[model samples]
Target: MLTIPKELPAGFEAYGRSTDFTPDNLPARLQAAHSTKAGTWGLLHVLEGKILYQLEAPFEGEQLAAAGEKIVIESEVPHRVKFVERGRFFVEFYRKAELTPG
Candidate 1:
């Protein structure tokens, strides 16, 4: 069974986001197994249609996310995505917020 975190860990903040992508425009790198850098997390938001998310070794499994749904990617976890139907989506990255002395 695939387990997705219900939310990002506390103290993490959004750092960046990817351009909206459709199946035709999805990057090659995202279609193959890849992982986020240490301390980084990713939220894959589906805007339209459906997508297949596959988690590689150590957490091997797959889940399908549809429009209005999202998938949380844990830091350093190997995973990949593909179109289950024509879809539009974007990935928002997050990392621990840096402490600032006030």
Candidate 2:
């Protein structure tokens, strides 16, 4: 596993851990554009080579996630990855914090 940063954006908390994957073993659907259910977010970690993270709706663009780099996936948003070269990476899921009564 790559050394992912411990700091997370405000209001976000990692719901799961120990997620590890690589291009050679990645599922076909994950390699394609797909969105998580509402309120769920994804964090892609690049441990080697380079990969492209693309947005399709609500926003549109492509980002390079190379070694030591990570790409954030907004909730209910369309996105995909195109392998640029031999690479290794993993994804971790996160969710927003629920507000407490004021």
Q: Rate the local accuracy (lDDT) of all candidates.
A: 0.91, 0.75
Q: Could you tell me the lDDT of residue 39 within candidate 1?
A: 95
Supply candidate 1's per-residue lDDT for 77.
87
Q: lDDT by residue for model 1 over 42-75, one digit each (tens)?
A: 9999999999989987787777999999988989
lDDT of 1 at 74: 89
Error of 1 at 5 (Å): 1.5
TM-score of each: 0.92, 0.78
Q: What is the lDDT of residue 69 in candidate 1?
A: 95
TM-score of 2: 0.78
The top-ranked prediction according to TM-score is 1
Scanning candidate 1 in windows of ten residues, the lowest lDDT window is 1-10
lDDT of 2: 0.75
